[model samples]
Target: MTAMALTQRPASVLSRLLHRHEACRGWLLLAPALCLMLVAILFPLGSTLVMSTWSLDGYSVDRTPTLGNYSAMLGQPMFGALIGRSLVVATIATVVTVALCYPMAYFVAFHVHRHKALWLILLTLPFWTSYLLRVFAWKVVLGYEGVLNTALIGLGIVQEPLAALLYSQTAVTLVLAHSWAAFAILPIYVSLEKIDRSYIEAAADLGDGLTRRFWRITFPLSLPGVVAAFFMMFVPTVGDYITPAMVGGPDGMMVGNLIQAMFGPMNNWPAGAALSVVMMLTIGLAGLAFLAVGRLVGR
Candidate 1:
């Protein structure tokens, strides 16, 4: 070959090699996260599906795959009631938390200026303690001889300790709200923080009142974070067993409590697995519905 042609061929090969190297690097960077997710999430989900098809007692796994467990779950009258109760509790808790947090988030984002960081730290400070301990603390406070009852009696607000204070749906809802309040606040605060000050100022200059400016510009823009927080709080609350078990009475027992009982006291792993699978499907559908609503509202 001619020397010039040979040199040009070498340069072309080197350029192609460098391009492939960059592409390989990008794939290598993504591989670890993909692998982690497959192992952590997808693998467990697949295993749950497989386990749901068989009977697993504490003694041994029955290799005979059957739909009997699912059928039993569906046929049980309590299953529908349990699911309905769970949805109601989670929905109410999510709504209450959002309502309470939005104003607080708005205050912290727009009203607080000098010590905003300190206030945020204070807001999140309660979560630094163990969650179980916090729940236990609430139990003490709401119990018959606890702080709230004592205060009410001492203040003459009530003649006697309110027997309905603990072990009721109301108690469960209150605790859920307390447990998940920070989850709601941070997201709404982030959304409010991202709003451009100029937009509000311009709206005011256009003779828009506070209500008009907020409705027209602020609320619409902050919606993504609100939607995100709603799901973040709702999904976990739906599956939460602790708060309900701790405070929720017989009437307040959620679907998660039943699932736990199937796994633990009942020794019915297959049933529990089926319940988990069903719950996952339910949550996935709910998420899609939420996203659709969010998009509709945003548009």
Candidate 2:
């Protein structure tokens, strides 16, 4: 009995410690997710970081690590240009999507008295289709002699199809905006919906107008959602190669297109990895800047 009691004492103490320490219990609960992240995300990032330091020797990889790829990027103007273009396009798309969707989200949140779920479903219905299909659909609509051009010519709005309508920076921006509209709408709606009506009522009782109430109470309260929408929209758009490939011609080729080329036809794995790392770092910095701006605005 004394031997058995001694054997159980350590196990009991450990059990009690685990039970008493909320942080330990919390970590235990989170262990599965953390392990999955380690496998899926961190491992790949680590590999990429290592790969970025390696170089290619004609038809073979030099296992010796060097910063030649990073140095090459610094010397090349094209790399900087493409990255800048991607940043600009993504920023424009995020701004446009959020600006356009805000009113729709506000209407749905404030004006719709019933069938709110149905409205949300309807709003998101377009996203249920394949993203590729949506991009192609936009391509068709914006293409020369396509729907919009056909209508414009038929109605005497223009005698010729607008070549500039498709395969341009504007086209890329427009497609990105349309693609991410739902993402923007949902967050803004959730934020607006969660706003307390009593505050608005209180403001009204104090003789404030609708615009003033909205700017002061509603908009401020919904900034979190707006910030979320912007972040969500911006991050994905910046790395999008597909939309640019489909709608953006040579004039609108972004960093993602270049990155894809590097990994594909260029067959420069180290350079591609280095560019990817740079893009990831750029995104992290941009995201941090966005969060800082959001905090400042919130204050």
TM-score of each: 0.89, 0.92
Worst 10 residues of 2 by lDDT: 6-15
Clash number for each model: 0, 0
How displaced is residue 262 in candidate 1, in Å? 1.1
Put down candidate 2 lDDT per residue, 157-241, tens digits, no spaces: 9998999999999999999999888999999999999999999999999999999999889999999999999988999999999
lDDT of 2 at 278: 98
Full-model lDDT for every candidate: 0.89, 0.94
Error of 2 at 161 (Å): 1.5
RMSD to native for every prediction?
Answer: 4.6, 3.5
Write model 1 residue lDDT over 1-299, tens digit each, in one string.
69888777656665667677997667767999989999999999998898899986568889688987789878888887888788888889999999999999999999999999999988888798888998899999999888999999999999999878889988888899889889999999999999999999999999999999999999998998899889989999988999989988777789999999988998888889998988888888878988898889888
Q: List runs of model 2 lying over 4 Å from the truth.
A: 1-18
The TM-score between candidate 2 and the true structure equals 0.92
